[model samples]
Target: MADITDAEHHIVAASYHLMKALQTTKLMSSDVRGILEKLDFHLSTVVKINEDEPDGDSIRELEKSVVSSHETITSLHLSYSKVWASGPEVILEYLEAVGEVQRSIEALEGMPLSRMSNGVLEQAKTTLHMAMERLQNELIHILVQNKQCFEHEYPVFEVYPIYEESVISNEDDSVEDASLKGRSSSETEDCAMDLIHPDVVPQIKSIADTMFAAGYAQEFCLPFTAFWKDVLAEYSMILYVEQLSIEDVKRMEWKHLNSRIRKWRVAMTRIIGVYLGSAKRLFDQVLGEYDQVSIACLIEASRGPLFCLLNFGQAVLIGPHEPEWLFCLLDMYEVLADLVPDLDTLFSQETESLIRIDFHELLSQLGESVRVILKELGNRIATCTSTTPFQNGGIHPLTKYVANYILCFAEYEDTLPLLLQDQEPVRESGDEEQNMDGEADPNPACALAMYLQSLTSILEAALDEKSSLYRDSSLKHIFLMNNFHYTVEKIKNSKISPYFGDDWIRKHYVKLRQHAMYYQRTTWSSLLTFLHDDGKVGKATLKARCQHFNTAFEDLYKSQTRWVVPDPQLREDVRILASKTVIQPYRNFVRKISDSIGEKHIKYTEQELGVYIMDLLEGSSKSLSHSRKR
Candidate 1:
């Protein structure tokens, strides 16, 4: 050290300052090591110290270090995070700061910490514990913000289709258009979830993985739970919007809602599955009840979107709809069934029980819906028969409607047995006839058989009603014959007859023949009675009988023009049978009094009368005089 200039003095002072700084750094390192060693010592022997032992000072000293370390970490996190900035860099720095505090606790934890007393270790562990919590909270905030941004940018919320009066009609064109319109809306929503933020799920999983590595599996549960809550909330919100936007489901065409529900179910499964399937362990932990109430909130929150499915179920069960509604519902349930594994893989026994209850309820609702549709089909059958009574010999329009409805019944054949479990087996007079004739083989008991039985009952009742419309016994018999004949023919022509059995066909056919025979006996036998001529009768009396015959035939023919005998063969048979009854007797009588009838200006020659009668079978009546020789 020579006597130096100002620059040399400044250099000497600067060197001293550098040396002091190095000494201070060394002291700081020693202090850090001493703190770490003390932490390890406390962890190692704290539990071995009996509460009766007089070592309060060491325990207090350790507690103070833990508190101070916790405060330092809190302060550091606040200082860095106070900038309120965002992005991967900011997130990484925050994670690093939290991880630094966690590493200290992990060092202490490695030193036989199981022997540590709960009171002392709990205090020392608080720093890392709180840091993990803060880290989790920060990550959750980031996740929520990310989700909010995704929602804002993509707006994937479901938009419920509106049904103005224009689409509500039951007209063929309107229903078809409404169906297509509904499917289009569903397709639009199908893509609604396709555009989610790419970073959302992965970022959450990354944070969860970090938390798990820090021995904070429970801490990981919180943020991931929050993440899933946000995800599910979004899903529920979309469903809510969709449910609200749905028009009167009970009254409007269901095709649109049906399609919308199917699409929504698929979207729900896909979106929820995307998360649950991706991070199996994370959700499994979140779903676990490590503590009694730890996961109750998550379980309850998970059920939010499921309510929409239940709502659709409610609509399906209670609404006045057809079995087609049930078909769509089953499709939706299938989607839900596929979705269950994603969530169910995580379920605890208690949670599984809860979900099982919900499923049981849903299944019960489905069963109820099936029953309702079956009942409605029965009611519709009654309505059809009541309103469109068999008119004219053409099959009742109701019969056609019932036939088509039976065909509709075929759609639910798979499910109908379940519905009918609570119902009485359908029995009908036609079915009984089949059993009596040994044609009622035990075909596998099925919905088709039950439906046909019910339909046969309805048709039999309608035929009875139609037969009552005519006052003349013979006409009544003919009306029954026509309706029965038409019904049997339709059954034979359609796919439904096998359900009724061949003997059912034979029974109705036999009844139709009986009716025809009865009509001949009741309506035409009187004309046959007149053929029993006593030779003792005078010309005046015979002429009287001829006039009487002409009057009766004219009355009968005129009154029958309105009657419908739809079967040409049956009409021809009746006409020919009547012709034989009238013409042969008249011809014999004419032979007996040929000159007398020809001489007296009889109203119709036998040949002209026969031609006039032929017109009756053709549903037209030419006046007997129109057939008179011109």
Candidate 2:
């Protein structure tokens, strides 16, 4: 039994040792597998890294290409640093060399800098930088050399007819013809002169493209913009655009200022519409691929001169408001308004939006200034008064001035409405009554019309006030008649007639007639009372009436001879009306008193009275005095 137990223990110990051996072998195999898997992963990663890197031979070839391009660029830059002065063939070679260098630099940038020796990479960059610098200088030189000069002493602006005669056959002619004919000569077409010489534009574009591709756009623009700005300044000088400050404009005398303002209008139109337009075309041609850069350069180059032009307008805006400035201000407003679309198109780039905003702000300011000046003109007309009566009871100077002034406004009818669009129409005292039955016309032209009507009404009111200056009621009526008649005739004959309308003309005509009637009643109605036969039953009373009538008629003739009527038709009408009022009655008085008071008692006969009345209102006091002597 002891021997069997020893055998079982030995078997158990052997089994335990076998299990420990198996466990140790399994652990060793697992460690070896993990190490092999890690090695495989590292191998794959190394392969991928190697795949991404250029081969040694490829790197050497790229290096050779870079070295060759660098040598070529260096040679070209040294040879053609003043490429603008070189021939086309040399320029082409230089541009080709620059292009080759640009491609090499791009390739070098794509590869790892570690692959290229630091020296090679630095040399390539330096060569490209120097080449771009030369190219920039060349571009500026080309632009300056190729700039076209104004050939004419005065800038000649051509105006083409808006409507083609082919479009307007006699059969198709209608009210449209009138409107088309009414277009101002100022509504002109653009005649863009070449700002840059046509021969060198492609060369400039090539240099610009190369510099832009080389990441030297800023360097390219710097010199290009600087040179062109001076060119534009010279062009402005040629256009007679003086860079006057606001204070300088303010200090100028009006006569000199007026001439300058005229020149300014012509210069601004030429600069913005023609010269700037040509510049824009040049930029579009040269930098067509880089629109933003082109626009930025244009704005930078032109902003100074453009602002100088606007400064003149600003000076005019803040200057003293004078009635005479209206036409020039209107001209400025029209030109600015017309250029808005051009400005919107030229400065459409996001980088150039500020310039567009400035132009629009100036336009708004100009429009506002125009409105204020118009209001000032109306105020001037309204407040222009004289304490003393105008001599001779003839048409007052204010009447003639206001009449002719408003007549001039009709020529600007198309432009005035645009400037006055936001303004409320000025109304006279009775305009409300006149327009109460009808809705106001919303047409823009009507706005100007309403304002013009108000001016006429103000003129009439001023004349009414001036009439009171005459001490004699008859003379007062005569003065009102003369002024109103003159005003009516002026309106009736001018383009201003359409603004006031037929009703306005008729209303004023009736007012003038009322004044004429009033004059007759005041001057002659009292004399008519002397002709009435009250039964006094005495030759003495009859002779007394005859004598009174004779003396009063002669006195009326003498006093009225100096009162002048400027219109021939109006003078004839007044004389005929005066004859109808007084001639017949005096004839009856003379016939009745002829038997009682003979020719001796009667100082004048009907025929003689007729001759004197025919001479009324002729403005010839000497002729009437000579007739009285005869």
Candidate 3:
């Protein structure tokens, strides 16, 4: 019995030394296992001693049970120490060690010892729970370090040039071979990926997965929300197309913009897939601020392109060049409609309404801009009603701009009808127009056609107002002729023929011809009547008539020389008509007057008279007076 007591004392002594060793030095996993084995043996020895002394004093048994409880607590402390040494990478093994500690506490509680072991069991459970919390915090610390990756501002928006293989000078050069030709060297420069790189989404997703696996999924939410919000804010600033001035837009190149938009759409789609897709929807369980942040990101992705178009439209309205932005906006819209589906699918109804509302607003603003410019031009035209000659011939100075605007409208001939479709009345059944794929469009109403028609009216009214600016009746007719001819030529040369229709153009052309005929018939008819009826007058009166004819011709020639006829064909026709009007009558007058006066009272001969008439119609009055020797 004494030897048995000594063995128990030695067991207690060895466990004490083991606990001291664990407290002093950092022990390896194997060393911890060995220490735990030694502690386990001591605990069993106490329990065995308590069992063997069942007939002894109850106080001795209680003492043995107390010694066994202390050894069990020491084993738990040793396991937790290993947790700190191994760190978060070994978190799974650490959890298993914690489970082992829990089972040991239960075993100790179930033992037939004194009720005081209950206090030790409870204390063990409390300590293990606190240790687990510490380990979780360590895991969170590791993830927080990873979160620093998103601290810097990345370029979320950028433009790059899209290059295609150049046309080879030699027909024999293959596409691949031609691609090898360089500006100054023989090496080719192939198109590379975007400088921002496309792997950003994958990198973020990989980190998120790793964090979830480390049991820090919930803890990751705060940092992720903060980081992503920063990303969105940064992206918003970089791609803020609305902040651009007219000069900035003037510097924009469409191909580069198109290329950047394409790549950006791709990136946006990928981010949506990562954050909202079914497989790893990291934001599904996140509520409150995180959820709002996630939704904000989606909204920005869907609305960013439209905002770009809006800003571009505004810039176009402010600048002299308006057509290019509209053209590029339409192209980008078409490309996105075909390429991107997630934006439509995610916010189907909202996207439709937003697109239509935004587009209509853009059209309304553009129409107003067109109206203002045309109105200003009309005011200028009203003020130009004077005898002064215009700088650009008979045509209005604004004709070039108006023609270009009309042609711009014509470029969207196919698109206009679709955008201007009549809005069907809302039914209780809620039926709507379906696209080719049989999906009903959410917003089907557009007034772009009416807006375009209004712009056309403004343009037409401005042109008509300009035509009335000429004071001379003949010059007014010439102004109308030149303007109508210009309109007809622009329509014929461009796709704008559709807007005016064939009949409208044909009718305007007829009006133009009638104006030309009126100027020819009425302009010189009274002048030609004087040279007629030479038989009714005496020789002296006929000589006076010849002198009056010379003075009238010079006055007419000097004034009409400054009156411009821009079109070559029309100018020739006017000259020919003028010749027909006066040439025959004047030649007859010269003959009759020469015969009647017999070159005695006549101030000019028939040959010199013929040359004067030629000069009058040919618009070269400088040499008319010098033709006396002829």
The residue ranges of model 2 lying beyond 4 angstroms of the native Cα positions read 1-56, 66-91, 114-116, 155-187, 425-441, 531-538, 620-630
List the global CA lDDT of all models: 0.55, 0.70, 0.48
lDDT head-to-head 1 vs 2, winner? 2
A best-first ranking of the candidates according to their TM-score comes to 2, 1, 3
lDDT per residue as tens, model 3, 354-434: 654565565565544443443343344333333344432366544544454455555445554454444332232543346
In model 1, pairs of residues that clash are none
lDDT of 2 by residue, 345-436 (tens): 77766533766776777788877777887898778777776767877788776776667667667767888876675787666555643345
Worst 10 residues of 2 by lDDT: 173-182
Candidate 1 error regions (>4 Å): 1-101, 109-202, 213-302, 308-355, 365-405, 421-451, 454-470, 493-497, 520-550, 565-596, 599-630
Tell me the spans in candidate 3 whose CA falls farther than 4 Å from its real position. 1-210, 213-215, 218-342, 345-393, 414-469, 588-594, 597-630
What lDDT, from 0 to 1, does candidate 1 have?
A: 0.55
Best by TM-score: 2
Q: Residue 349 CA error for candidate 3 (Å)?
A: 10
Worst 10 residues of 3 by lDDT: 178-187
State which candidate, 1 or 3, has the greater lDDT: 1
lDDT of 1 by residue, 1-630 (tens): 013456754665565455444545544654554454444433333323343434445444554555555546555564565212356766665566555545545544444433333454655465566667666776666555654322322223343222222211211112122221122222222222322244555565556656666777766665556566667667555544245322356665566566556556555554445433333333433333344433454565465555555565556456555634545554444445545555465344456555546755776666666566667655655553232223333445445444444544443445555456566566645633345557643444444576667776776786577567556787778767766776778677765566667877887888888887887788778766655567887777777777777777777676565466778887888778768767877777767775755546366668866876676644453344243322
- The lDDT-based order of candidates, best leading, equals 2, 1, 3
TM-score of each: 0.54, 0.78, 0.50
